[model samples]
Target: MNNTLLPAVDTNLVPVYAEIFLLIAASAILLIDLYLKGSRRNVTYYLSLLAVVGCAVLTFGDFNSGATVYTFNGMYVSDPMSNLLKLFTYVAVALTLVYSRQYVTDRGMLSGNLGGEFYVLALFAMLGQMIMISGNSMLSVYLGLELMSLSLYALVALRRDHATSTEAAMKYFILGALASGFMLYGISMIYGATGSLNIPDIAASAASGAADPTILVFGLVFMVSGMAFKLGAAPFHMWAPDVYQGSPTAVTLLLGGAPKLAAFAIVMRLLVEALPSLAYDWQQMLLVLAVLSLAIGNLTAIAQTNLKRMLAYSTIAQMGFVLLGMMAGVVGDDTSNMPAAYSAAMYSSITYVLTTLGSFGIIMMLARAGFEAEQIADFKGLGRRSPWFALVMTVLMFSLAGVPPMMGFMAKWAVLQAVANTGAVWLAVVAVMFSLIGAFYYLRVVKTMWFDEAVDTSPIVTPTDMRVALSLNGVAVVVLGLIPGALLGACLQAIEMTLRS
Candidate 1:
């Protein structure tokens, strides 16, 4: 092997320094946490939040306003899309730590029993997501995926004493490993055919009809299958419910929340960016996946008695809507509308993550010592006990149901509009129908909270900081629902910038 270094002047490290800072910060936190004992470990917790916030600031400051620029020999990249996604990721993660703080502390995660591993590992996972978001090449994408997956696998089993948590961790690790293998095999096939792992080169080869169609399509199959598992889409979604149900609520939120943004980025790279020439082929596959996801996710969610498990299924259905918007971009080589299509999906992805973050935040808030708060029955008297939280949960439920007067409605509407624009009316219709079906379960939760009598009669007490954060998080959902133009435009602009590059 030839050992060579790229020109110093040509390497653009400026754009990726946020991720580097995250790596250093996480390492420093790990070392600092080692010396802290008991509740004093809250210092590590605070530092984790600070680290995430600092990364957000760094990402914002370094947001490139120009075209795509490659760094690290073109393995890493900077673009408006990545910049915007990274910003959102930071927000999701910071908010996650806020919501999870009391929950973990109550559960012994902060008392030196679980050590500071949760915070440290979360920071590391955040780094992985940042890596995945900016990855420009196959090798980089694989690296990011493994890093994020490995962190999540550990997080699920953070409560090692719990049999369910340990079982969930094992299931997730096995499934995740298999998915990774599939993705790697697909990458190898593409590399074999194109002789390059760079996204742009693979795209060029496909566009020029230089790569063998059979090989390209076969690789795409494995790639999409792998992506389906990561995104928790149906037929490949077996791991989500078990993992969501068995993991601690705080860890569950981390698994379900910010990672969706990275998953969307992975899809964008693998499908939209690297293989636009094969859009027609993959679009059909996505269509099937979307329909199955909507059907299985919604109908199955209706049967789930567990709140976390229901949300797991809801995540699947929500991802279906995202896929609906994504596959609408390519209609017989007319890629002019690709930005709107991709951006609509991006908007949906971001909205779903934000809404899910708040919903799970509330779930964690409801939980107390020795109580997991994982059941629909647990929310029976939420309205009587905590009207503010009940209302917040209501907003999230309505949003997830795609009901009017909530951000979720606008998200679904935007994606449907994008799909309709591409002449996919049937797809939009299927989505709406499943969305209506999905509404039943969300409405059921609302009914339980507002109308049913108390099951436990426990008071919901939360910290001032958590209360304030939850209020702001809920308010953002409502405000964004009412005025989604700015965010919608931002999404469009980011994708437009990417398309230009």
Candidate 2:
């Protein structure tokens, strides 16, 4: 069973205690939930929230202490970027739980005696993401990715009675497994070429012209394919719409948020950190991926009647923008612009997830028992009933559509700015065009909520905490859009400190 633990220095284990604490907390939540009365099940919920808070505090404190610290023989690490990303992940996951509580309860996922598996699995998933964000080696990255992927599969299928959910779970499991295999095969190829699974070693090998060029390129292609799939970028984004539509909204919220950060981390770790010498090849691949993703994702989303599917495609297009920013990193091999280019992509990813967290939170807010609120039509006349939430949704839509004075606009602009700085004006132009095209559906959602006649006319109900969170989230989106300097600077500094190769 390999119970013998690997020896780790104190510095390596410094930030690791947080992961251990979360593991213990998750197990505690599971055990504690088993004995609690159904009426007091909220205890587990609060405990989960507390655990997230605890982790956030720990990560935040760690961020101020140093810029980079490697551990576990360099398989794990802590740095400004990882710490900042972890802080965001904790907040995102906590907010997901808050928005999802009523939805799960109404569906009997937690109320009708569904076990605490949902909460427990969520913590485990967060743990996996944290690991991925901090992983410094191929083995650690793969392990973290699989851990997160497996938890999501279970979460999507948690409602065993929902046939659509079960179907989505099966499809997700199959596709996710294939993606993982592609990544693993690519890792093996890279290992064969460079004789190293460590990111820095791979970079050194590739840079020194020591690795087999053909094998490196081949591995790069497969790795990009796998990453594209994981990020739900085009040509590999087929599963998103179905999965989003089929899963419970709570699960959808979890799926849509936080994980993107982990995916971005892997991108930074593998392609950016491990193979910058192969930038020309991977950059071209990302170009194709970005163009296709924006085209197909935007063009297709306009026709979606389901809100979830609409957001699904929107995700693909947004990821295209991320690719554009990332591809700009190695222009002309000057390497001087790498930090801003990489940080632009990082900030873009964070902003997109932040906006998405709010958007999906509102979707969950509008939904109730017997009404999934899955359809665009379901939002008709929402403004009349719940103007506050309607306003929130409107802001979210405008942001997603990249309208000015909103976070989505700023996010898209940051990426485009980075791309344009690299003289990829044509790519920027295409991205902006698709963004315009994609606005139709987002604007459509906004219009339905504000202008259409009342269909349900039900009263709006939401928890006080969620209401507060929603307000703050919506405001943060707009405010950050207006003033993104601090956060963008933070991202740039993080990249400079940790990934300035």
Candidate 3:
């Protein structure tokens, strides 16, 4: 290999260091689980927690540092965006481990894999996301995306004997492969047009007026399509509901939680950094997808009787709101397009992930062996059984519906304002309409819990660890909503960093 093609040998390797810590912890957990038995298995949980904490520490330790360092030519970079993404990834995965232990163990999802596979897979997925956030080249992006997706393919099917879990995994695998293929093809097209795979070079080529518009636009479409699939937007969201419904509750929690942070990072890289020149075309494409996702996600969710499935569609709609923020950032008619739009979009993404994680945490609380805790009916009179859980779910549902005094409401408001600032009045109207449609389902869940008669069966609540984690998970949602300054501030900083860099 040519020496010139390699990345800088000495640079801020803190990001890589975080991955190493996680790898070592994961391997150690696997070995310990293999040799140990019974209650000792729980040690893997603490090890995973340690891994996340270590990663978080590294993230902050490397804060505010910016370098366009290249390892393997221009394949990777340690920049502001990557740093911000890793921080969020750490938080999300940590919360997943905290809330998921009881759910996974009780459901038998921890069998045959040293009881630490979920944590290991989640860490690897985070590693993949880290790679994508730092990716400066097409090769890096594909590697990161595959690393994340492969782990998820197995994760969704964690309960191998469960028919729905197997089906969900199969669907996700096939669809994910197709999306990756599209992205790869688009990368090739972009390279053909620009004669380079490095993102900065592609942007420079476009700036120099040497790039072909046709090929670039074609590549942009394919790239956006793949991202849309990742974001679970309309027309590309066919897999989300099934996957969410089929996977174990803990897996659903993981699926919805931290990955969105990585997805946003990927979007920022591909659309905001690499293809800003094609904003008009992609903006229009995103506009249509946003409207469709909002409309379909909300309207269909109202008719769904399954809680996980409902949340699955709700997630799709939330992505629409995110798209609105992104469109405003890139194509708004407003004078201050860069930071204002970016801040709004990013803040929305951050808050959405937090709220979604908390929402899934409620689902995990009710999950136990021989009981999926997925259907809406299962929540009937839940208030009588567990008032605290009901309250937490209420907060999650209302926030998702954009009710005021909650972070989700603020997130929606910020994006809607950005959209209106861009003079996209119709898009804003669609968002409002969909919000109401979504509220119906959310409200139904609350009503079923508080007003409906209690079912005779009591949910299994064996694990002491889960009960404690679930309690915190519920409390965290309200706490985050009521005091969201730090999180929002971090998101704003992330936007500034990425744009300025």
Candidate 4:
């Protein structure tokens, strides 16, 4: 009943202005496609790229103090946390376009059907992600999440004539719908209990130092279950492999990257911001999800013959590492250790996105007409035939497997150390053991490329744009792996901003 106690509802919208600009540009792309027709398709690409650069510039200008900036009557927020994630999403999507468009075009996935739809859909997806990042209320989070999910469903089925592509899209749509339902139901329950959807309001209400045990605990479980499925965690990971395998390689690349950052932001916003009083309950739930994800992801990846499917499982395992850091941060008895643990978790997320995108870049490189190159057998003797590609692939696989001197290794070390420091040594131990099991599958890719006999396969023609993009993507992983300080610093800065509030 006390309006004055609620969070402020007026602040500068400058931070999220980039999202607005992107919306305009996306509409322009679609219009251009409709009017100009066939020959001017390339114009859409150029405009999309320009929009991305513009958004990046806006994001750069937006970063400043760690103040919580309410926009649109407390529905949105703009702080260092949201800004950092928005910048990352921008960069990731830009890179995806640069690398993926040429492949999509080459495969006839972009012809005869409003060539700009992909760009438009991508913009909508980015909009959703931006909203999720700055969402101060449950309504905003769900709206943004649905926007992103709907765009992705259409994106996966862009090549509608293909049976596999349609199937993958359908599976994703069904699973996503279920996850959304769970999240919505949980939000309703929370609203019924507290009569509020604003995160800070929920926190303030619970800050009297106690929570309604049953309602809070069940709501937390439902929330976590929904987020786990979104992040492709175990027991909810069945869709990932099939979707990755069946979709076009370009779609798979998008599926594996940027949206993950959105997922992380949503979870942090809901759990840490809204339900701080119920930390102990969520901690145990996350630990179970993490353990199961690590076990299922690692053990199942070894048997996968398809590269896309293997990477899907690998993503599940990586999600476990993210959860491990989150759980450690929450469960740690020493409050002093929380910052470091959370930073580790956030850093792992950034590194995982970069490494996974780069790995998928390689797969996209080998993909050509009538030859999807989805199978690991396709990679046999790749080292002998294409030494440079093999070399890059080797680094990506090693990085994913958490091998030494790579960013993945550093990320794992950071999280596992935090888990150990929290006195969760058993969880840490299990993580390490599964990491080794995960390594075996990554090494198998290496073995096929290097040790196996070279096949007499036909020469695959690669587009110059894709070739250049793949090279940059692949090299970026190794370069970042060698010097992860910048990304790590960004992660720490973002985490500090989020928690210091």
Candidate 5:
């Protein structure tokens, strides 16, 4: 009776090699950091960078293969979209660490009790993002979201002694918890309706009309509400501005950059993959969110004097365009336009993250110990302070404003085109009008930088690494805008492959 053999697990570790390696690397670095003295903190930083590079190396094959491979009992997937997004996540995390090094160090975030936690937590956060990007099941996506959110919460509160930082972290944690609860409840309802947590199974059930429509729609509403909170789309964007403005600039960058990609990935997985049958319902919801986000984000940004707060509002507006692209994917039960529409959303998210990195990098570079350059007036006469960085900042601002020959313009145009292609010409027109209104604030920043007199003309000193990285960041925006074909083509191919598989 005891001689019965258990069935062997059918598991492939190859698909998760990057995640395994990163988890090991982060743990090793955390332990290694405990032994290193203050001066040796750079070792931990380099190790984290090496870990990111290793992830890229491991994921490169998957990206090139252009094949979809599922593992972890179909909870995780390795596909062109996941691989491409993971690669970009690696780049974003690496650049974030590089840009944050001096900023964190100057504020003692890298020394004393904290000692290298910034880098360690960032790696952990990246691990979460990778999981989110590859998640093929609702449970896996939720797990990844919590991991990333927890790490970011700690990062925001890193400056524990600072009242604003502590308060901001608390606010973020509370709202984040609420969003997670909403998502969890939605998942439960969906599982009850469809009898599955597997995304593809849910999709098949929904497509077959085998699930309870009333419960499904209710769950979908809750799910979309949670996602909107995560994406900083309005009506659910109360936490973004305060969190953005209150966290340290370095932490603010951490909150803004790669996580957006992960958020977008999961949105696609849940809405496009799991609930395509409810396309009209969710599209209407997205339409409302897009309009509200555009209106609130643009109009509110005009009144913001704090640069971080303004950018937070700007992020909301940018996400509005992304929502537009997302909503246009399946127009009137015809999914012929899905690939182009979704790819455009993907491109908008990627480009927005690229531009956001440079914008925050400049803010950090301008800040010194005990002085955060967070005010709009802080940029007064910045062009005279350091012409190159000022020009870099200008490029970044132009990109955010969706001005011509910058990456943002291309991103906006792509989304608008996607919307119009769906016969939503009026929606596209509204978005453009909001874009025009948003441009005023961005141009005002430029005006302050070039035309205003200096308040504190101290030399703009920056680390060489940051200088070079920022330069490349700015150049990438302009270059990508001018020759947008390659990235856009890649996005389209990735989306096409993902949907086909």
Candidate 6:
């Protein structure tokens, strides 16, 4: 008898404790929520928040350990970058649930047949984001992307009775599917060229010039295009405005926030980590996309009368800065500046998500039962209505405009500095000019809030928790701007450690 003995597989679940915990917690929450009725739904909300906190606690230990760990047969990784991004993702999800509580309740999104599906879907979406952040292989990244995208699609269409919401969801779903198809085709091409689906193996193959160059370049192009669509960069950003304007404000917040961080993580994974040999090609593409995004996003935002649509365009412009940072990472194979440049990009994404959450939170706060305060005109004389929140809105607008003493300014400065360090002065100059143009629209909102006459003089009633959270959100932006060294240092360390590992 010739018996063949197979080698034992080594499996470590420690690297993915947070993800596993989140998955189990979210599933349990979904089942537990069904038994809760009426106002008891608050129990589900609190449970979801607890799940996020538990995930954060689970992740913090790994992050503090400052060690790179891989598990699942090299298909998953737990690194400084992933840990940091996951922490931020948890914070973003928690804040979204908090700020959205009253808004969703008023819109009937959390009641009746929906029955806490919003919370369940959000937790699931967050789980998907965590997976994406830690994904070490193409297959894992794609799986995580689809999971997150599917959850978001459902969230967008949560208001099944609303025609506009349904339309937006359809657009998002179709475009998202197409983007995923592009990415999958690209992954297949890459696998064909390199004979590997593992990111590090692909990197080695590409670096050694063992991969087929023609097929690899084509795959990179398609993948970058897919990444651009996910980031809402121009030319691929058609669905953003429609979806942002049509979905419930709370849903918009969910869409615009943590997903950006996850998207940034995958961009780093696929482009920088897996295909550094083709940096020049992808850098050129990012440069063009960045310029187009800035020109289109800033110029078009000026014409938008809908606040949500305007913010959507603003998101596009902000992503341009991030792309610029990514593009600046490698200049003619001099990779010394990569960590700094990519860290700047990371900082830009995190700050943008923070500012967006506050902006949307204010929008939701203004919305009452049966009325969506979506129009730009709705902000007229908001200063007279609620001076505190109006001040918060002004701070948020200033930050988005890249005004000094706000986090956005520091983020833009960091990106521009990184670009300049690479001798790309022209790119930095163009970014600044476009930013100047962008400031007009943001300031216009401030003017509307503080200068325009009061159309509705009703008091803005908000839950104490949201009020406190929004205030802290706004304050953090300013404080971070004034002293950005800590966050910037953390980002730099995270990127450096990630690349080293």
Q: After superposition on all CA atoms, what RMSD does each candidate show versus the true structure?
A: 1.8, 2.4, 2.5, 2.8, 1.1, 1.2
Candidate 4 off by > 4 Å:
1-11, 64-67, 209-211, 332-334
Candidate 1 displacement at residue 5 in angstroms:
10
TM-scores for all candidates: the values are: 0.97, 0.97, 0.93, 0.95, 0.98, 0.99
> In what order do the candidates fall by lDDT, top score first?
6, 5, 1, 2, 4, 3
TM-score result, candidate 3: 0.93
* Reference-based lDDT, each prediction: 0.91, 0.89, 0.80, 0.83, 0.94, 0.94
The list of candidate 6 runs beyond 4 A from truth reads 1-4
Give the winner by TM-score: 1 or 5: 5
Displacement of the residue 145 alpha carbon in candidate 1, Å: 0.5
Which lDDT tens digits does candidate 2 get at residues 1-501?
565686545465676878988999998898888887675888889999999998987888889885577877778888898998998899899999999888888888884444677899999999999999998999999999999999999999999999999999999999999999999999999999999998888899999998999999999888989999889998999899999999999998888889999999999999989998888899999999999999999999999999898899989998998888889988766777789888988988898898899988888888888888889999999989988889988998898888988877877888888888888788888888888899899989989999999899768888898899999999998899899888988898899988753
Q: What digit string (tens of lDDT, one per residue) describes model 3 on residues 172-258?
A: 999999998899899899999999988888888876779999999999889988988888999999999998888887888777877
Q: List the residue pairs that clash in candidate 2.
A: none
For 1-501, candidate 4 gives per-residue lDDT tens digits of 999999876756675788889888888788877765665677877788889888888877766555667777777888777888888788788878877766777777668757678878888898898899889998999899999989999999998889999999999999989999998888888877777899888877766644466786677777888888889999889899999899888788778888888888887889878887777777788889999999999999999999899999999999999998888766534456667777888888888888887788777778766777788988989988888888888988998999977778989998999999888798898999999999999999999999998774666566677677667767877777788788778788878877877
Off by over 4 Å in 2: 1-11, 111-114
Superposed model 5: Cα runs more than 4 Å off: 1-8
- Kindly indicate the candidate among 3 and 5 with the higher lDDT: 5
For candidate 2, the TM-score is: 0.97
Displacement of the residue 178 alpha carbon in candidate 3, Å? 0.5
lDDT of 3: 0.80
